[model samples]
Target: MEWMSWTVPTAAFFIVIGLILLGMTTWELRSPSVLRKGLLPIATTRGDRLFIGLLGSAYLHLLVIGATDWSIWVASALSLVWLLAVMRWG
Candidate 1:
């Protein structure tokens, strides 16, 4: 059987995600989240905000890539900003 090939960037991406999940799990175990309202209409916990941020970032990246002639770097930067904003105030 052939093994899957992994590139450095791809591996790094997964590694970062794993680290975030680990950190979140540890934080949750130490102190559970409480629902709070932010800029988003509904109250959300940390995990909910994280999920929304990640999903929004995906859509932002796709929209930027599909609807514009911007470089991937630009899309990535925009997605990062969106993710941060969502996590902070969504």
Candidate 2:
């Protein structure tokens, strides 16, 4: 279709998301997660933390881009850190 064009970065993004889903599926099948309270206010399972992390990363990227004159690399780095923190202790 005319709207189906895929840039390299866009394709790579989807590929990464697919891989994350696949890995999460495998992990869940191998070892199930238990809901636990972390630094986050609510109890979360692995998937819950993953969702929060991804959402927070998106917000962090937006904030970095909108609030600073920094480069995209800086925003990407901040987003990565936010993702890691959320995954670890969210």
Highest lDDT: which candidate?
1
What tens-digit string does per-residue lDDT give for candidate 2 at 29-48?
Answer: 99999999989999999999
* Residue-level lDDT tens digits of model 1 in 2-90: 99999998899889889988998899899999999999999999899888998998999999999999999999899999889988988
Tell me the lDDT of model 2 at 21.
83
Candidate 1, TM-score vs. the true structure?
0.91
- Per-model RMSD to reference: 1.2, 1.3
Best by TM-score: 1
List of clashing residue pairs for candidate 2: none
Clashing pairs in 1: none
Q: What is the Cα-based lDDT of residue 24 in candidate 1?
A: 85
- Please give the CA lDDT of all the candidate structures: 0.92, 0.90
Query: How many Å off is the CA of 64 in candidate 1?
Result: 0.8
